[model samples]
Target: MKNEIDKKLTDKNIKPTAMRQLVLKVLTEQKTATSLPELELEFEKADKVTLYRTLKTFEENKLIHKIEDGTGSVKYALCQDTCECHPQDLHVHFLCDKCKKTYCLNDIPVPTINLPIDFSLESVNMVVKGVCFNCKK
Candidate 1:
């Protein structure tokens, strides 16, 4: 698992430090987007500054993407293998109101919106909030 995490970081042109590997592994294993507070609980011994910097580096390297579900706190999730996370590569995100979890709907591509000629697009964030299947059950 460590080897895999290292490779993933290298693939994104990031040097796989111990902290980066640990943080990435946690995100990958969770199978869902996670917030800083949640991660803090998981890595109680880790310095908040170090963890925050690690997350920032991952985002800068396109190794992960941030999710803003209008929930006040931001979340981060592992990007798809081919995801560059550009506007065209953006996809829909689902936020479960009950569980307060954010899910990346990678299979559902975000529809392209034709903006005015004068407008430019850099990034797009679309989140659909509702009770998830597990919550309904």
Candidate 2:
């Protein structure tokens, strides 16, 4: 796990720090996504600002994908295997309303559209909002 994060950080040209590692470690803990505040509360030593900066860095490197809920809250989930900011690992992310977390629907790959000749694709973020199974009662 550490090696994977290290390699990703290096690829993003970001110097790995203890605080950054801790923030990433917390994100990796979930089977779903997490918010900045959620992570701050979960990590006793991580302050809100530090956690946000760490998340910013991670998102910049495509290490994680941000799930945007219409309510205006943002959540994040870990990148799947072979997520090289390409369409392969890019897909619709599901955000459970009740649980207030995000999830990568890897089984459902993102749709692709042909672009103009000069256009180049970088990364994509698709989010589906609803309540998750665990939250349904």
Candidate 3:
């Protein structure tokens, strides 16, 4: 597990520090997108600033992506191995109203948009809000 975590970090050109390795481990275990506050709960003794910085570094290196699911709190999820955070690489996010958990719909790619000649695409964040399968059950 440690070797895998280290490899993931190294692949993203991020040095595998203790904090980063631990944070990445937590992220890997998540079934849904995670927020800073949620991650804070995982590492009670660790400094919040350090965790935030580690997340930022991972995001900067494209190891993870951030989601703004209209809940005001930004959530982070591990990116697909081939993900480069491009427009076409973006996918729909599902925000469960009941469980309040956000999930990455990786199989559902965002539709292509036709923009004016002078315009360019930057990023797309499409969030679908509804009750998740677990919540429905």
The TM-score of predicted model 2 comes to 0.75
Please give, for residues 57-137, the per-residue lDDT of candidate 1 as tens digits: 999999899998999999999998998988877999999989999999998888998999999888889999999999899
Ranking by TM-score: 3, 1, 2
lDDT tens per residue, model 3, 26-115:
999999999999999999999999999999999999999999998899999999999999998999999999989999999999999899
Between candidates 1 and 2, the lDDT winner: 1
Give me the runs in candidate 2 sitting further than 4 Å from their true place. 1-13, 114-124
lDDT over C-alpha atoms for residue 14 of model 1: 93
Count clashes in each candidate, considering only residues at least 3 apart in sequence or on different chains: 0, 0, 0
Model 1: lowest-lDDT 10 consecutive positions: 80-89
User: Which pairs clash inside model 1?
Assistant: none
Question: Candidate 2's residue-wise lDDT over 34-110, tens digit each?
Answer: 87777878876757787788888888777877777565778888776467667666788887778666777888888
Q: Which is the winner by TM-score between candidate 1 and candidate 2?
A: 1
lDDT on C-alpha atoms for all candidate structures: 0.92, 0.76, 0.96
Q: How far in Å is the alpha carbon of 70 misplaced in model 2?
A: 1.9
